[model samples]
Structures are given as structure tokens and as C-alpha cells.
Target: MEHEDAVGRRVYGTDHDDPSPGPRPGRIYRELLGGPLDGQLFDVTDWMPEDLFTGALLLAPLGMYGPGGRADYGPHEDDPFGPWIWGGDTP
Candidate 1:
């Protein structure tokens, strides 16, 4: 899981993280395999961490249903139209 970035710094562990209590095997499989969401959501709770970018990207679509359920892009909203360039000029 190691890679050299454009600037030559080594990057690793795109899939690795500090482990938590993780799922009780077979729970996630059953959930995605057409089970119910009752116990399903808790299954992978331990695997995910509090990452800003990844969390935002993942939850933005699902409308995050927790204490932060209200945080979401509106369903009728249009995609952002401009490049998010910083400290630079576009020509």
C-alpha cells in the first residue's frame, strides 16, 4: 500500500486505519445482501474514522443520518459550476 507522490514522498495505508471493535462478521454481508438496516449500520461503524474529506464525500450523497443528519447537500441543488482554485487566477 505504498506509493510515491508527485513530489516523491512515500504514501501508504490508503485502506489502513486504527482498528476499532469492528463488525461481527456476516452482519455487513447480510446488510448489503438485502437484509435490514436495523443492525446493519452499526456493523461497519468501527471501521470508519472521522475523516473530513472522505466523510463528506461519502455522506454528502446519503444525507448522513445521525446527530449530523441535517448536514447534506440539498436534493434539488445543482452541481458546483466553478473550479475550486485557490490563490491563483483563471484565464
Candidate 2:
């Protein structure tokens, strides 16, 4: 299958934290989609020269950029790590 472009393609990621009822501590998962990886919780060891931002974005959340640019399935402070979307909204 042809992989989607890393830039806009959505990526779900989880930071290392203790698990909790709402959002696990170390397992704080979030979807990485759009914008740069400016607010990443973890370090992206590797990424293609051109795909650097793409890989970085995968490891972080959209909120890193800002509030308005955050993803619909937000991992933001208000809606952190939940309701992951694989293809559509039914997960």
C-alpha cells in the first residue's frame, strides 16, 4: 500500500508516564498530526532529511504548535490522549 505523506498524515503517539484513570502517566498517548514537532515529549532519534519534521510531528502532538492548530482528536491539556482515530471516528 502506498503510505500517506508524513506531513499531514495523522500519527498516534504516547509519551512515557504512569498510567492513570483518564490519561496514563508514562503511557500518555497522543496523535501526531500536522505542523512541526515543537512541543515533543520525547526525542526523535531519526528522520529523513526532508521528512525530519514529518517524523518529529509523529512523536509529538498538534498542540505543540498552538491551540487552534491542534488536532480534532486532541491530546491537548483539555483533551489529552483519547478517542484515537485510525481511519475515521469510530475507534
Candidate 3:
């Protein structure tokens, strides 16, 4: 993918001539939302299912919440994190 940023910065660009390698499956797990946990937190492991290796794969992280957690209907009022809803759409 090749594109310019908002400030006209030539960002990531991949050369088409370069030979690409085949897709490889791997596993990654994170404890907290942003950091490591001392004990067993939400452990998630991901791998390309056996049938999905023939093409490129886009992996997105999924999470599970415990009791008393607010359902993330939309962005928070205080904006603790970055913009939740992207694009021009509003909540």
C-alpha cells in the first residue's frame, strides 16, 4: 500500500517488483488493553484456519469483558482514547 499522509508525507509504499512471500500463520496474545498482565488475563490466540492459507489475511483482535463492564456502544464522552468512530459518520 502506498499513500501520502495529511501533511503530504510519503508514507508506506511497497514496490510491486519485489517478490512477496507466502502467507504464514502465527499467534499473538495480549493481557490488558494496552499492556502486559501479571496473571491470566484475556488470553487470545489466532491462526489462519487451515482452509484460509491460499490468500492474504487481515486479522483483527477480539476481546471479552468481565462483569460490570460498559458495553462500548460508541466513543466515550471524555475521549479517553482516540476517536472511536472513524470516517465522517457520527454517533
Best by TM-score: 2
> Which of the two candidates, 1 or 2, achieves a greater TM-score against the reference?
2
User: Would you estimate the TM-scores of all the predictions?
Assistant: 0.13, 0.20, 0.16
Model 2 Cα displacement at 9 (Å)?
25
Regions more than 4 Å wrong, model 1: 1-15, 24-30, 34-91
Q: Write the per-residue lDDT of candidate 1 for residues 1-91, one digit (tens) a residue.
A: 1111112221111122524323333332111111111121212223333221121111211233433222221111132221111111111
Q: Report RMSD (Å) for each prediction in the order shown.
A: 16.8, 15.1, 16.4
- In candidate 3, which residue ranges exceed 4 Å CA deviation? 1-27, 33-39, 47-68, 71-91
lDDT of 1: 0.21
TM-score for candidate 2, residues paired by index = 0.20
Cα lDDT, all candidates:
0.21, 0.29, 0.22
Candidate 3 per-residue lDDT over residues 35-64, each given as its tens digit: 111111111234343422221111112213
Candidate that scores best on lDDT: 2
Q: Tell me the deviation in Å of residue 30 in model 1.
A: 8.0
Per-residue lDDT tens digits for candidate 2, residues 1-91, read 0122222322234334524213223332333333343222322233233432222212223344443343322333433332222211211
Quote the positional error of residue 91 for candidate 3 in Å.
Answer: 16
